[model samples]
Target chain A: MKLISVNDLSLQIEGYFAFKHVAFSLSQNEIIGINGDNGSGKTQLLEAIVSNKTPDSGTIDYTPGVRIGYLPQENPQVIEQSTGKYLEEMRRLSKKLAVRKDQLQAMITYMGLSPYLDTPVNQLSLGLKRQVDFLSAVAGHPNVLVLDEPFAFQSEKTIQRMLDLIIDLKNNNSGIILSATQFDKRIATNFDQLYLLDGDLKNIAAEQKNEPVSLLVFHVSPNSMAITPDVEDFLVSNQDNQIELEVPLKKRQIILNKMVQLNYQFEGMRKIEN
Target chain B: MKIRILLKSYLQLYFQNFLYLTMLFSIIAFELLANHLLEIGNLKKFSLLLIAMFILSLFSTMNLYYNDSRQNKYLKQKINSHWADWSSQLLVAVITNLFSSILIFIFSLLLRDNVLVDFVGILGLFSVGFLGSGIATLFQTQWYDHSTVGQIGVLLFIYLAFSGSVVNILTAVEWLLPPLSKIIMTLQVTSSITKLLPIVGQTLLYAMILFFISGLVYKKNRKNA
Candidate 1:
């Protein structure tokens, strides 16, 4: 079922069209990544979707009862006036918190946000603020999540955790829409549907721009099958006591050395044509 | 639920601009004025002094537009409906002024020397408070941040209202000038209660119309924003 749809929306700003003939739809358990630079109408589109502002000429159609968690583009000063109050207010709005309290607690603990619970949002670093912002949207288990620049200004560890959470939400039948200026290649792999919005919404090719042209297969004895999470991140497939991965040509040597240092007894390393 | 948050925010901002401190000042001024004016032996004098101090305090505080500072656009994201936000903020200020009027009346009950109010006089003041608040709201919405032209005109209007005896000569109708003329005449001549009903009704009518107009203007401004 289509959770939300935007049909031929046009937003004009300062005598120019920020977005023209923009259209897209999001479905359950699917992720649509919007890619755009500054002032490309990404934030306006998200606000229109949430019904915060009316579009110049378009209809953002979504059924009632579909609570959308909108992470706004501008940092609201009200959220910073008091610490932890914003979190509480956000939690109060989420009717699902009564049932998902434990889950939320575990997520907060894992994200290391427990210690800073009382810290003012403005006092926190940009990265921590982003985490707090992300927590506000996810706590409700909202039907649709409209995240604007969710991944910006975050550390690698935090980014990985957010990515994991996004993947988890997708698995739980939640629709996600996000915009970013630049992202790692894994985002392409995680969200297969990507749209490039300059003046209008355009779908980018599904083919990963930096896809590895060569494949490396390593065969290890059944007793020596040991892979750490860091290595598993790049693992494409594993079966029959053999692990296959498409490591970029530039990083293959370092990855091979890291595997050797991990004491994995590999019988052979063969290169396969892409 | 949303109103509670907006009201809390509005009160916090209002106090941040020294509004709470001035409330303390108003109470102290009232006490000193009562003690000093007690010798005059006019009960109405005490009520009028207190009312003047109350108006002074209200006039010192900024008008009740959500834009405390021209740059404070924080409510745009926190609250969704601009009309609700704008109306509720103005209502809080008006209600606070109403409370002030009520408190003054309650204080008047203990006075035996001063005829602080007849039934009609107290009702006149209450109506005046509402009408003043609504006009102030409209004035701030239109010119508070944009320009001071309306505020200068308000000062000129105050001069004219104080000289209502002279101003009423231009009109032949006895009750045409409203609370200003009637209120002045009562202070000068007979303190009759019957002549006050027209002023009360006119003040109320003007207040409602101004409030409705301010709401419409605020809604349009929000849409433009």
Candidate 2:
């Protein structure tokens, strides 16, 4: 299902262009990773789509009655609310986007947030509060999940869990748009589509990108390299007088055939250990 | 149901933060009763107590209105954020201010107070409170962006409006905001509110307009949020 379509969106603040001539459409069961450097307007683009910022010109059409959940990049300014009440109040405000109690409990348990549920939000560490913000956005099971740096200020394990959560939501037909300044191979690989927003939203086609399977590094010795069965099963890279072999998962045989067909020479077969 | 949820949750928060004003009012009320320096009759004293509560309520209500958004943003992130938008925040102002005002009035009434004034005074205070909340809510939303500037502007306006007759200068344009006119009249001369109906009518009218306009601000903010 087409969740939202943005057309020719443009916004400027303080006479500086935040974004211009940006357009994108989101559909169900898709995870779109927006990549950019700081001040490159990744967050601004998400804001435009999430309805937080009005554009100077453009139209945003959402399929009628679509629910959205957003987690901002900053820790939400919370003073008096406990983590539990914070989530509950946000859930209430989002009427018709009901999330059952058990589901919240499950996420809480998984995040080890059970102990901090009743803790005042401001009093929690930044990372804990960030998780609360994450839950507030994801708990309602929104049709469109807009996460801006949701994994920031957290552990690697938590990041993995959040990535899995996005996948789970996608499998359930939710459209997820994630804005991340930093890149991770696993996360980048998981995105159905990647976009680099630098004033303009540019699509990084999925097929043109390769997921790293294996990295094989070796020393190149001027035509003294020997191509053997062991050395043939990898991709070859010649850089700075050194040759590195990269082996794509399950394509080692094809790489071997390519090396043999090309009459490629290598010093020795190597697989870099992690 | 949604409003109920937001109201209830915010009310809980209000009760917590409202302690500052409640304690302030309680201390002042007790000192007045203990020192025996107030020479007025019991009714006047009780009325004065309610007025004090109302004033404190106004201060705290403004504080709540300003801090609610500054402090928490969970509701702001939700899809249907109207529950915690400026209008709803103003509703919290109304509810908390009224709650404290009425509670003080009733509690003071239980004390021995002879020679009671008519309901006009209470009605006048109530209308003033409604007006105060309305204006405060407006400041909390529209003027809130420029914190220091807005606070200074509002304080100046409130002082000029209540102390002198600046509202009268703006009265020709006041019909658009009838509440300010009513507030001016009510504060200028307490006896003027004896008729009561016009005051109440203007209170409702002004409150509706403020809420409606602030509601638009909410929609606009949500659109850009």
Q: In DockQ terms, which candidate is top? A: 2
DockQ of 1: 0.13
| Candidate 1 lDDT by residue in tens digits, B80-143 | 6667666676667566655555555555443333353344445555665665556556666434
Q: Please state the CAPRI-style docking class of candidate 1.
A: incorrect
Off by over 4 Å in 1: A79-82, A94-104, A120-127, A207-274, B19-64, B68-87, B98-133, B136-225
Best-fitting candidate, measured by TM-score? 2
Give the worst 10-residue stretch by lDDT in candidate 1 chain A: A205-214
The list of candidate 2 runs beyond 4 A from truth reads: A79-97, A206-274, B8-58, B72-74, B77-91, B102-123, B144-225
Against the reference, the lDDT scores of all candidates come to 0.64, 0.65
lDDT of 2 by residue, A1-274 (tens): 8999989988888888888888888899999888888998878778777776778999999998788888888744545568887777666555556567777778788888889888988899988888888888887788999999887888989888888888988998899999888556556778888888888778865433443355544454554446554454343556775556667556655665555454454345544443
Clashing residue pairs for model 2: A52-B224, A52-B225, A53-B224, A53-B225, A54-B224
Q: How far does residue A235 in candidate 1 sit from its true spot (Å)? A: 15
Supply candidate 2's per-residue lDDT for A180: 84
DockQ list for all candidates: 0.13, 0.34
- Superposed by TM-score, candidate 1 places the C-alpha of residue B189 at a distance from the truth, in angstroms, of 5.6
